[model samples]
Target: MDVCVCTPQEWDTIRSQRADALDASLESLGAQPVPPVFHTTAAPDPSPFGIQNDSDSERDPDDIPIFGEQLHAPSQSPTDTLRNITRSVRLNVNGVPRDRSTWKTLRDFVDERTIEDVLDTIESDRNALDDILARTSDYPESLSNTIAAIEGSVPAENTLPSMQDIFQAQGIASTDMASHLESLAAHFEQMSTALEHHEAGETFVHEDLHDWGTTWAEMNRDTEELPAILSEMEERLVSIDAAQWVPVLSQSRELSNVNRHSTKLVATKRTAQQNLDAHRRILDDLDELGEIMSEMLERQQAVEDEAREHVALLHHHIVTIEDLQHRFTSYQYAYSKLLLELARRRQYRDASDRIVNGMIAQLNAMTEGTFSSPQSQASTHEPEHGQYLPEDVCLFVQNAPTRWNVVPHNQELEVLPEIDSDLLDDARLRVGTGVAALGASQSL
Candidate 1:
């Protein structure tokens, strides 16, 4: 087969030297380091349930005795009275209380030495439920084998350049495609002179539509002062709902749903300003300049939808003046906590009426005329002998007589009642004039 005819640049330099020797044998087999597949297999016979035994005439398939020959009910020893009546008929079929002496005292208190401390507390609660099910099954299989070993270590197809490296990158992009089409035709003639100066600045009007028609005539004179500022905030919320110490605020159905959404946003901003002044008088009698630029873009989209409904009716009149200033600051904090609980219950009823008038002037200075009325002490003088005696027989006849008719101070004296000190200086001048009128009513 000696008829050779290579040519196309010697088949593009033998296909770029066999694609650079197959990219240097795939970069030396990707820097060669994969060696860990050690799957040794012989250790599985520690069979708890994996039954095997094959000798002694092939018998031990886990000693094959499961329900062997099936006729079962015979072994009954533990002091069997028919094994305590078949364990009280299996503790009444398991709902337990068949009380054969309380299950023979809990089967002699669990026999195998307390059932190895209840199988060591059920083998420490089954090794804490098998360590919470082996950390919920080994943390999602070790986060899905570390995201499948990071998407199987990434390299799927990238390095394939051969046909003489795409014919020398297509002869360096056809020698820079005619200086990139003459710098893309001088960037398309500077984007056609910036789109003919943006079509001569779109032929005119936009000073933001004459500052949005002088901000829509100053938002229609501020929406005609929003009905006198919502009628002076509904007359200061009707004088704070006729104030008697103000608490009412069930916001009158949120101020009548904010005055029916500000009268339906002032009738939808006067029907979007009469459809933007009838599309600016049909764009000033359109002489057909494309119907006056489509009626000035429908009057600038109806003045931006009536300035977004007058900024949502001035944010619903600033949230109804911040909910009537938080209900006038909760009605001046409930009328200053009801005037400080009525000046603390009028200074606790004037200190309990000056401590009940100094305890009625010390009980009228110790029972003043020793409780008189025996017809005013027999019209003032006679019952005096043992002045009605019994005050422990006048202190045992003034301290010594056992009872010689117990007559102590025979009786006409009555004097000693001075110390009222003007009822303790008028109860310390009415408690210093109620603490200086509660410190001048708390400095007003």
Candidate 2:
């Protein structure tokens, strides 16, 4: 069965028609009645109730049959008779000429349209509530498992603290993980729902996946940004602490004399005096050696003077041999002339040639003998070969000595050899002086 409820416009139209009918009836009965103009004046305006003036606006309440339509007694419209209108009017029967008419008119205008709309709104709200309840009831087991896994994966340090621990640590009484999550949990709840919807391939009204991704991205960005700043700050604090360490350490450890050691200085006195006494003895020995060197030097000088005189005497004997060779050549030339004169008479030519040739041969033999002999070497001893051959030559040879003595450059003249006649006539005079001296020195 299709049941129809009357709206307020329908109720008001029905009430107006009923009131007109009653007035018509009372007027026909000849009782002093409400005037027709007054009835028009008394009718309620539908404008305030959001009701439109159209063909559907005016109709009789009983004309459409429904339950509860008889409360406006003589009018027969349920809206005209409802007590809520009477209560809103706050009126008594004494003020109106037709009490029933006013009562019916007020009752008819009891907002039936608003009531119908309210009922429709309530039915729709109920359906919406039922749909939400069904969706929540069928929440996927997979979604629950995913949530459990994600929660379980977090480490102990990252996980929220227990209720008692949070209270102790933060000094907040009765605070818990749920209390902390209250501010942000709705966003995660929404994200979880959207992720499920997206996985299911359903067209979601809100992009919960995008919201979840953005939230996770922001969380990761914060995680990345915070530690780098904190690390830098921690390093700066470490450097600051390091800067203060040297003074603190020096203050804790004081200076001490444990690092020092003893050293001694000694001076010796006897060594200098001993060295001086030794040096004096060395000087006395050197002076004695110098005197001996002076005596040896005088003997060396005498030997050198004698050697020079011997060389001069050898030079004088060479000059005398040159003079003897000149005189011998002259005597040979005179004897050859005498041989030529005897050969011209032819009386003893051969004998003359022999005698002349023999003389020249003898002269040549004497000249060669003198030239080859060590005549200069004989000056170092007695000149034994320079002694007499003829009486006059012997006299010259005997008087000329073989050795002489040289004078010093600072002194007078050379000392000539002395020959004593009596000494020349002595028995040693006939002996070669070098052999005789050698024999006599050997005998001694």
- Give the per-residue lDDT digits (tens) of candidate 1, residues 1-444: 122233323433543543343334234323321111100112221211222334677674323221112123323342333333333334343322423232221112112343234335434543443443343344446456655654554434333324465445445544554454464465456446546866887542446435433333544565565566445434444323233211342333344333222344456566667666765655544344456456656755665554444434333333332332233233223323433444466566567667767776666654454543344544444346656655554342332212112122653222111112332343344354445433432332
Q: For residues 111-158, could you state the per-residue lDDT of candidate 2 as single tens digits?
A: 345434533553454344344334334334534654565455443332
Model 1 misplaced stretches (Cα beyond 4 Å):
1-294, 319-321, 346-350, 355-367, 370-376, 383-444
- Cα error, residue 405 of model 2, in Å, equals 75
Q: Could you tell me the lDDT of residue 105 within candidate 2? A: 26
User: Quick one: best TM-score, which candidate?
Assistant: 1
Q: What is the lDDT of residue 235 in candidate 2?
A: 35
Worst 10 residues of 2 by lDDT: 259-268
Model 2: residues with Cα > 4 Å off, grouped in runs: 1-279, 306-311, 327-444
- The window of 10 residues in a row where model 1 has the poorest summed lDDT is 32-41
Whole-model Cα lDDT of every candidate shown, in order: 0.39, 0.37
